[model samples]
Target: MKPLLSIWIMLLCGIAGRSFAQTKTSTDTVVKPPVQLKTVHIVQYNFFKDSLAFREEYAKSLTFRRLKWYEVYGGLSVNINNLYRVTQFKKNKKKITFKHMLLNKEQEMFVSRVYTPSLVNKVTHLDGDSLQLFMQHYQPDYAFIKNASDYDLYLAIKKEYEAFMKTRDSIPVQP
Candidate 1:
C-alpha cells in the first residue's frame, strides 16, 4: 500500500511539472493589420440637418453622392472635437477634411447658413451658362489649380470670366 501511494504521488507531480513547463514559453506572435486595411471608401450623401433625425431621413434627403459625411448634428461635432484629435465620421474612423463635393441649390443653402454671405452670393449667382462660359474661357493659374477650395476655384473662374467679358466688350465692332 505504501509503495502504491508513493507511485501515485510521483505520477501526479510529473504531470503537474510538465503542464507548468509547457505554459512558460509561447510561440504565438502578435499580428497587426496593414494601414490600408483600416480605410474604406463610401459614397456618402450630401445632407445636413441641425437636429437629430433618423438615418432614413438623411437617406431620403440625399441629393447627390459624395465621398464623405458632412457636419449635421452639433452635438456629434462637439463630441468628435472633444474625443478625437481629428474629426471623423461616426460610422467610419477615417480622417475628416473638405473634399470638392458639388452642392445643389438646397445643399448650398444648408451649407451657406454657416458660411459667409459673400460666398453665398458668389456661388448662388453662378448659373449653368456662367459655369459653362467660365469653363470655356478661364484657365486657372498653376497656384490656383492645386489644393484650392470650391469657393476659391469659383472665385478664380468668376474673376477670369469677368476679365474675358471686359476684353470681349472692348473689341471694336466691324461695320
Candidate 2:
C-alpha cells in the first residue's frame, strides 16, 4: 500500500511539472498584432477638369497628327450620323475608322481621369516602381470605370491591392 501511494504521487507530480513548464513557455511567447491596410477618402469626380483635359488632348492630336481636312469632316459626319442614323454613312469604312479613333482617344482619357496615379497611390499606399507595376497590371477598362462611382473605384483598387499583396507574399524567395 505504501509503494502504490508513492507511485501515484510520483505520477501526479510529473504531470503537474509538465503542465507548469508548458504554461511558462506559453507566457514567454510574444503575440503579434495583425496588420491593417490604409484607407483613403475619395473626392467626387470633376467634370470641369475632365472636359479641359479632353480639349487639350484633342488640340494636341490635331496639331501633332496634322489630320487632313477630309478626316476631320468624316469624324464630324460620324457624330452627326449617330444622332440621325444614315445607313449609307454607316457603311462608309473610312468614316467609321475615323470615328473609332476619336472614340478610342476619348476612352483613354476617361480611363486616365478615373484611375489617376494619385488616386491609386492613396488607396494602395504604394509608390515608385511598385505603384507603376500595380497600375499597369490592374488597369481598369473604360466601360468599368465609366459607370463606377468614386467609392466603387476605391473599393475595387483596395481589393486588387489586397489580392496583389497576397500573391506577392505567397511567392517563394530564391537565393
Best by lDDT: 2
Clashes of each: 0, 0
Q: How big is the positional error of residue 69 in model 1, measured in Å on the Cα after superposition?
A: 51
Cα error, residue 19 of model 1, in Å, equals 99
- Report the backbone clash tally of model 2: 0
* TM-score against native, each model: 0.22, 0.45
Expressed as tens digits, the lDDT of each residue in 1-175 for candidate 1 is 9999999999999999999888876565457686665667896443344323433444434432223234333554544543343233442222111112221333444443433334434654645544444443454443444457787767765676567667755544432
Taking all chains together, the TM-score of candidate 1 against the true structure is 0.22
Structural RMSD, model 1: 24.0
Q: Which 10-residue span in candidate 2 carries the lowest summed lDDT?
A: 60-69
